[model samples]
Target chain A: MIDKVIIAEDQEFANLSVQKTMDDLKVKQYDYAFYCDDALAKIQLAQKKGEPYDLLITDLSFEDDGTAQKINDGIELIRAVRSIQPGILILILSGQYRPVDIHNLFENHEVDAYVRKARHDVQELKAAMDALSKGQRYYPRSLAQLIKRSNTYEFTEFDITIIRLLSEGYQQNKIPDYLKEHNIKPSSLSSIEKRLNQIREELGFANNQQLMVFCSNAGLL
Target chain B: MIDKVIIAEDQEFANLSVQKTMDDLKVKQYDYAFYCDDALAKIQLAQKKGEPYDLLITDLSFEDDGTAQKINDGIELIRAVRSIQPGILILILSGQYRPVDIHNLFENHEVDAYVRKARHDVQELKAAMDALSKGQRYYPRSLAQLIKRSNTYEFTEFDITIIRLLSEGYQQNKIPDYLKEHNIKPSSLSSIEKRLNQIREELGFANNQQLMVFCSNAGLL
Candidate 1:
């Protein structure tokens, strides 16, 4: 398992929650900083001491309380850390996750993973760690899908219904039952999976969740 | 001291967290619902059984996953519960909280308390419950202050310094030391308290936290 992480977040409660997750994951070598500058300083000092951090977890925005900071935001801090320690991994734990921002982070900035600060964020963070450990970039959807804006995609009524069901919290496997009950054509589980897979491939979305969000954004569901 | 309560939130983790708090607070008769419709049904059933709920803690947004719901949103659900069980206290636990929305909720919606979903929200929830027990509203600040929008308020450099400290994670008691170290005038603890108190009273914010946010919003800090 990976060790030696630095969490740079402003909210003490959120930071405490992250620490709890780190504890649960058996990571004991993590340190925390409330300011981006402080986080950068720690990373620099660690590098100088020849004991560099394996990962950097940060929040996108930090409240400015008139305390002057060399690095004011997460983006700059990420850049600073990247220039000094090019091999280090960086993960973002933030509440702000717009599709455009996700695209920018992966395509432009070298953010390794993004775990949105939500109710099950601990689990998400754990999953991200697992992926990052395997040299995989962890984000909500594939990078190709994230960059694919709400393109004018034609949706059949069946597509709309299935996407809406997924958005409503129905698991894909369970969706066959709902479709069968409604007497929708190709209601078999295999057929449903095939159709979903086709849609996902066509839209470049990785999963049903992404498909649901995109269709909903396009006012198709 | 609330005997029986119902929580209507979709996110299982947040629901679980609330249940944990209820347990910590020794609230034994609480129930959970994943949808606003289910919550209403539970409340209605309880009312029919002559075991009406004492409190309703709910979120403003519920995921619209294909399930048909009479109560589409939290506001409508709150109104529905208020009509059937007029005596029940209602508390909103939502992540989406803006100053204008807070004003509308207190002034027009008759919500008993509002606990924004954040880190340390459990403590905030406990504080809200204490206030609700005494028949006082629990919100970030008073209703009058919420309705008062950002007017042209002049701020001295000294006033900015203290609020800045508070925003930067420094407690009010710690401000005197920073002030004294910097050779700022009125560096005593009493003086610091008095100044913060004056600003809080003038702006009608209840605590330093709220004052810091307001001043920061107004670009004073």
Candidate 2:
């Protein structure tokens, strides 16, 4: 379990909000650093002091005094930590939310989760902690749905209908009456039922209930 | 205080996802409905049965009956409930993130909170429940900051600086050195110090630490 956490962000408001959230969660002990450099120092110091942090929370943009194009900001922070301590969890909480920024955070840097500071709920940090404690990757539910929907193929109208109906607990016998009442004719009733079953089979649902839960979790329901 | 919740979403997945979340929270006794009509009926029935719901969770869109118009969406659902149960806590969880949609939810309908289905963390839902239980408004911290920065002009750069330095336990004398290091020549050092004092005065902060905590909680830090 990740017993200790370190928050690094030069922005005063963001840093304080995170700290208060941790406090509200009644976290027993933790350390916070205001700058990226000091954050690194603290991480290394913890290692030296024999009480290393299990998680790192950082923002992407910080006060960069140097002109050298730093490869690391938040992304590099994770990379550096991974180089030294590969198993340590990294979560990025930043105001940046451009698609490119999200892609870079997820694809190149391999961050455990990337939370946009602009859309964050305190539960996000707690969820990250919960995920770590439970030995699971803690991606935001919304982000997961986004990634799944964006990368996966868009659902066809018919596919949506079948899934929607099945999710509503419509038995094969009841669907035709509902479809007829709704005035849409996809095919023969058996074919419609077969297609529904086919879709369920493809999605690996054991029953209509499982399919509903699947779509619901995927944010498609 | 809200031991029971009512969900009014057309999608079975959404309804079940909410049910699962409620179950995860150990809120064992809750009810849901498939359509707005059914949901409204359930609420009325619960009221008549002397077990009125404390919260209403609804989705903005419904796939039922091939309805595409945005007229009777989540906002409409909120308005419907308000007419009968004006004091009921309402939460909108939707995939949409349009500024117009959010504005209508908060400004026009006065929803307790707007959670984007795409960005919401389940842990955030828990945190929100915690706050709601205490009768305090709970918004995702990131969203609060974004709204504060984008919608209001009350927070100035100097105010942010003061918040940052104070949060880090930097004394008044040391704050000027911190500003100078940042290369932000906001008139003279005394002027900068005066700005901090003025902010302190305006916010009714007794000390720099108080200002820092206030800003943090307000999403201004």
Which candidate gets the maximum lDDT versus the true structure?
A: 1
Ten residues in sequence with the least summed lDDT for candidate 2 chain A = A63-72
lDDT accuracy of residue B148 in candidate 2: 49
- Model 1: lDDT to the true structure: 0.74
Candidate 2, residues B125-181, lDDT tens digits: the string is 677777777887666655555554443435667766665655544555666777778
Ten contiguous residues with the weakest lDDT in model 1 chain B: B212-221
Query: In model 2, what lDDT does residue B120 have?
Result: 32
lDDT per residue for candidate 2 within A1-221, as digits (tens), equals 66688988655445656777677767667788766667888888888798888878888755443444334376667777777777777878765333334555666646776655432245566777677677777666666566655434335676667666654445556667777778767645787767757865666544443444334433454
- Is model 1 an incorrect, acceptable, medium or high docking prediction? incorrect
lDDT tens per residue, model 1, B16-116: 67777788788869999888889999999999999999899998777664668777688889889888998899999876434444555666757988886
Q: Go through the candidates in order and give each one's C-alpha lDDT.
A: 0.74, 0.63
Residue A124's lDDT within candidate 2 is 64
Q: Candidate 1 residues A1-221, lDDT tens each?
A: 47899999875556766776788888859999989989999999999999999999998777665678787788888889999999889998876434444555766758888877654567788999989888888876633463465443556778767766755546667888899899898787788778778987887765443454444434343
Give me candidate 1's interface root-mean-square deviation.
20.7
